[model samples]
Target chain A: MKLWVSPRAPSPRRVLMFIAEKGIGDVELASVEIGRGEHRSAAYLARSPLGKVPVLELPDGRALGETRAICSYLEGRHPEPNLMGIGFEEHAFIEAADRRVEFYLLGTIANWIRHGHPGLAPLEQPQFPDFSAAQGRKLREVAGWLDGELQRQDWVAGKRFTIADITAFCALEFARGLMKFRPADEGFEALQAWRDRIAARPSAKAGA
Target chain B: MKLWVSPRAPSPRRVLMFIAEKGIGDVELASVEIGRGEHRSAAYLARSPLGKVPVLELPDGRALGETRAICSYLEGRHPEPNLMGIGFEEHAFIEAADRRVEFYLLGTIANWIRHGHPGLAPLEQPQFPDFSAAQGRKLREVAGWLDGELQRQDWVAGKRFTIADITAFCALEFARGLMKFRPADEGFEALQAWRDRIAARPSAKAGA
Candidate 1:
């Protein structure tokens, strides 16, 4: 199986981190250059209908595009040291946690950076400064909430590290790199600490 | 177990339809008036941290939020006539399909309507017409692509009806109601046909 990835993108990094966390190997990596519009090429479009990066091409030659889906598939394939939950109940809670981070935190950061960053203008179609600013404010609100959650629990999901942590870490990393965002600077010490802890993980540097 | 729901909301409706599809009748329904600001009440916030609709209160009194998570939990509990998928491979394919519909179709429609519609002014913090217009155009582009996909497959996730269909149907229904969008009117016959087929299902009117 081959994994099509764009090195600089966040979603592809998610799959890479998951693979590393699970200690999975033997998967071939194919790079797609987003800057040069390689992802928009006819062959790439056939692989990922929406022209997104980080598509997992199955042994049967089918392309699976969603980051969460690709990770879930990998988890199902390699269940040792599971990053998703064990049972139905745990699955529900972990998924809820991941969705919360994905929707409010990561989703907000992506929207804010995409619309606000000058470097992303080619990708955003047309930048909306006001909307981007609104998303920025919303991101801070959600980040503050996340900081509180981290204070109450060790991982993004709960006591144990999971896919949710990978998601949140990647999101904050993106913000730190592009938005120059820092939780500690905004009085979110707990979040900053959590970020530091995750960054120490070998998987954190996966595909960096 | 009680399901907290707001009737007019798309996310809540997604859960309702899933319940109906699964033929699960033991679950009790609790209403939250979103228009009356009841969802913002402290009591409601305790049940759902983000105050989003369609929260499932477990028998142990834990509130499980996020529509997909809730549905997955229910699917785990009731496996007959599965909506997610059968195995890891099918699950991956189905999830990829669902994410495509959710992110491109439903997400775009929600953004467009939230910023464009007058009645939604209360929900959207500050409306941006340009962003709304951009989202509307993106919605059309996605819907057109979905129309082409439907021309090739019978269901949203292909072959059998699944959660992806439910999600796509809810999204299209929301557009039909709020945006006055008709796939056929916009020259998307396959999408219109698929919509009509799903509408004929008893689950389509489950919560409505």
Candidate 2:
């Protein structure tokens, strides 16, 4: 199998970092340039109808998009050093935690970028700064909530590092593209410590 | 196990409908009235940190939130009917399709409601009508895309009905709650037919 990736994007970075942590090998990578509109080409759209990056193409020529789905497929194929979870309820709980961060925090960050950042004007037409400001408030609120969770646990989901940690990790890093952050000043010292710890891992440097 | 749900909501309805589809009989139901802010109760927050509905409380007293994760747990415990997928690749592909509809179509519909609907103003503070209008355009565009796909496949994901169909079904219904819909006039005949089919199922009425 091979993967089409835009290494610069947060979605693809999540999958790449996941692959690194799992010690996945043998999957080939083909780069797609988002700035060049490579992902919008008919050929690429045929693989991913939504024209997004980080598509995993199976041997039979079928491709899969969506970062979590791709990562779940890897979990299915590899099943070692499992980042999803161990028990039945554990997996379900971890997934719930992961999706909470994905749907709220990550999406809030995207809104800030799409509507607030001038650099994204071409992609987000007729941007709305007021809407972005609302999303920014949500980001800070969500960050404050997560700070408490981080203060309690080593990992976002539970006792050990799981997909929840990886998802929050990616979202927090991608947040930097929108604005420079000061975790301590924001009263997110626990989040800062967690981020620092994850950044030290070899998997964090596996982007591209 | 028991579930906390507000059947009127889209996310909770997804889980209830899925349980109906799978003939899950044993799980008990405990309603959470969102209109009354019952979800924000300290007891509810202890189970679901995010204070959302469709939380499945295990026999061990631990609860898991997020509609998809709750459904996934049910799928894991009872693997009959095989709603997730038959193989690793199939699962990934199905999930990709599900997420496509989810992240784009459902989310767009949600934006329209959150930002445009007067009833949601309290939940979505400082709502922006301009952003909602843009998101409305996206909802229509995504509906056009899905109309074509529904014409080709029996279900949203592929040949067999799956979780993807359930998600889209809930989203379309939720859209109507926000505004009246005329599928034929809107040129969404295929989507209308698909909705009708899913509505015919005994599971569809299990929302409450």
Candidate 3:
């Protein structure tokens, strides 16, 4: 199997981290340069109509896009270190948490970056006129919410180190690069510690 | 099991259609009026922090949000009439297609509606200030893309009806209430006919 990825992308990073956690290094990597607009090319579009990255091309040549779907497929195929969940309720919990992180945290962060960062202006149409202010506010709001959620748990999905953690961790890290996380905020103590712990994972370092 | 849903929200409609498709009426329905801001209550937030509707509370008191996840859980519990897929590769294909419909079609449409509609002005605060115009353009782009994709297949996931089709059909119907599909647009004939056929389904009628 070959994974088509872009190094600078958050979605592809999620997949790389999952592959690292699975300890599957035998898979080939096909790099797509997003800055060069390679993802919009016809060849890449054949693999993904949305022209996004982190597309997994199976041995049979069929390509699977979507970071979550690809990750889910890998989890099903290699169930040793379960990233999704072990049982039905666990699965549901992990999925619910995962969606929460995606829609709430990651989605907000990505939109902020896409709309705020001048470097990404060309990628999105009709550039957001008030990018910086909007993004700053969104980032603060999302971080506050995520930090509050993290304060009550050891991980994103309660106890386990599931995909929800990975999703949230990746997004949080991505946000940290663009903006500073308020360490003084009482709500984020657990979240800050969790970030450090997750960052120390072998897979996290390897994927990076 | 009980489903917490709203009357006009598309996400709940997805689950309602799934329930109707599976002929499962044992699940009770609980309504939440989104327009009246019932979903924003502290009680509702405890159920789903995102404050979205279509939360399926299980018999065990665990709630599952996100339409696809709820559908997957339902499919797992009721596997006789499978809506996901039959085999591994089929599952991958269905999931991939479902994600495409979700991210590209439904996601875009919802963004357009929530951000663009004056009726939803309260919800557009920090996320989108002038969301309507951008959302309108996004909705058109996705509809055009779906039209092209539909030209090459019988269903959204090829050969059989799956969750992808359900999501797309519901999204398209929802879009119709917002903006009409342009029949004059070339290559949308198949999509138009397909829409008519799916709209005729008893499940579609019953859920709507």
DockQ of 2: 0.78
What does candidate 3's lDDT look like per residue over A86-185, in tens digits? Answer: 7566776788888888877888778777777777776787767564466567666666777787788788888878898889888877777665544345
Global lDDT of each candidate: 0.92, 0.85, 0.79
Report the TM-score for the A-chain of model 3: 0.92
State the DockQ of every prediction. 0.84, 0.78, 0.51
Query: Could you list the iRMS of every candidate?
Result: 0.8, 1.2, 2.4
Task: Give one digit per residue, the lDDT tens place, for model 1 in A1-208.
Answer: 8999887688999899999998899689999999889989999999898899899998888788899999989988999888889988898899999999998999999999999999889899888999999999999899988999999999999989999999999999999989899999999999999999999999999866
TM-score, candidate number 3? 0.93
Worst 10 residues of 1 chain A by lDDT: A5-14
List the pairs of residues colliding in candidate 1. Answer: none
C-alpha RMSD by candidate, in order: 0.8, 1.5, 2.2
Estimate TM-scores for all models: 0.99, 0.96, 0.93
Model 3 spans > 4 angstroms off: A181-187, B126-131, B181-187
Which of candidates 1 and 2 is the stronger one according to lDDT?
A: 1
Instruction: Quote the positional error of residue B114 for candidate 3 in Å.
Output: 1.4
Provide the global lDDT of candidate 3 against the true structure: 0.79
